[model samples]
Target: MIFYFSGTGNSAWVARQLAEGQNEELLSIAVEIDKNKEYKLREGEKVGFVFPVYAWGPPEIVLRFIRRLKMIKPEYLFFVCTCGDDTGRTAQLFSSAVARKGWRCAAGYSVTMPNTYVSLPGFDVDDEDVETQKVHNAVARVRFINEEIVSRVQTKHYNCHEGALPFTKSYFLRPFFNTFLMSPKPFHATEACIACKKCEKACPVNNIKVTDRPVWGDNCTQCLACYHICPVHAVEYGKVTAKKGQYKGRLLRDL
Candidate 1:
């Protein structure tokens, strides 16, 4: 089974392409988290995970779901992570995380997709031209990865884009980002909100509730689904995202 967790459609698009190319079953990790069902991979079936890189590392939701899932180590296990620029030792961290669960990631790949992180200073969504080019490149990258996985290529690191200072970014800065920045407290709808419940419905983890306005819960994974899915330019992360562009968050409809 190919499991995926996406916030703004980048990883979702990659996962869909891979599943179709490899003829693998696609499953949503977020949806499966609440289930009591048990899963065991057949002898020949391979396992794959597709998710976005968050704070230069794998998202907390992915690691959490990995711990929750029950499965026999497949003949080939792999992961694909989407990122705006580069992943800093994310592959290393992801491989170690899965190793702790008695599963080995036979290979890992990173694809540069459309940028969606705009909550911080000097960081915003990519322009139309850059975004389009990244999407175009990602399609080709995923195609190559699909063929590699289908061939059961067991390279520990396959086509990973790990930029400079991998250890510092993954180990040092990632912890700080997860601790201080990954929170829902700064999220609130401005006066432009129309009381539309789209944010509540778009949240992969059900961390949003809409009454007169949307209220965020503490269970959030900081995926920014609500901020991106708002039809109006109402959702803001404090004052930072007020002037930032919005991502379409296309795959939220499937959640």
Candidate 2:
């Protein structure tokens, strides 16, 4: 089984491709979290976790879900992280977290996808051509990962960088990110909002409430779902996002 958490469909696309290629069951972490039940992996089963990199590490929601998960001894375990630039030490961090639960990580992989974090300065969504290329490359990489998983290849570690700086950056930035970047204080719906409540529904954490417009709660993953999935493009993360391009990996019709 492959459990995945996606904010704006980048990791979702990767998870779907991997599941289709490997003939494995695909599970949504968001859905599971909503179910509010512990998940138990079957004995001797192959398991995988797929998610996007958040501040060089796993998102807060993903971490919480993994900690609460109950699983038996799986024959193989792996993780795949999707990122716009590099995954930093996201895989290693996840491995360490799961190790505390007595599960050994067999392999880790990273796939570069379109940049969807448009809130940051100097960062915008990639162009259509670039996103297309990224999707093509990601599909190929997922296929290779599927082959390795079938062979049960045990990769001890994996990272976007070969040096130690990525590790240092990830370790230091993760705490800061958890403290500041994950908050929903900066989010506000614009005048274009139709009070559709799509943002509230799209929020995986259920942190959004729609009244006259939409009110953001403190529990936010900074998943970009509210911004990217908004039909009227009314959700804005401060003034910077007004000029930033929006991307959700797939068209609204496709979604």
Q: In terms of TM-score, which candidate is strongest?
A: 1
The TM-score obtained by model 1 is 0.95
How does residue 239 of candidate 1 score in lDDT?
95
Model 2 Cα lDDT, one tens digit per residue, 1-255: 899999888888788877886678999998886566755666566888899988888887888888888767678888888888876778778988899889888888888888888877888898999988877777677788888878878985563432347776688867877776666788998899999998899888788999999999887889899998888899999887997777866732242
Off by over 4 Å in 1: 249-255
TM-score of 2: 0.91
For candidate 1, list the clashing residue pairs, or say none. Answer: none
Each prediction's total of clashing residue pairs, residues at least 3 apart in sequence or on different chains, is 0, 0
Error of 1 at 207 (Å): 0.6
lDDT agreement with native, every candidate: 0.87, 0.82
Model 1 C-alpha lDDT versus the unseen true structure: 0.87
Q: Please report, as a residue range, the 10-residue window in candidate 2 with the lowest summed lDDT.
A: 156-165
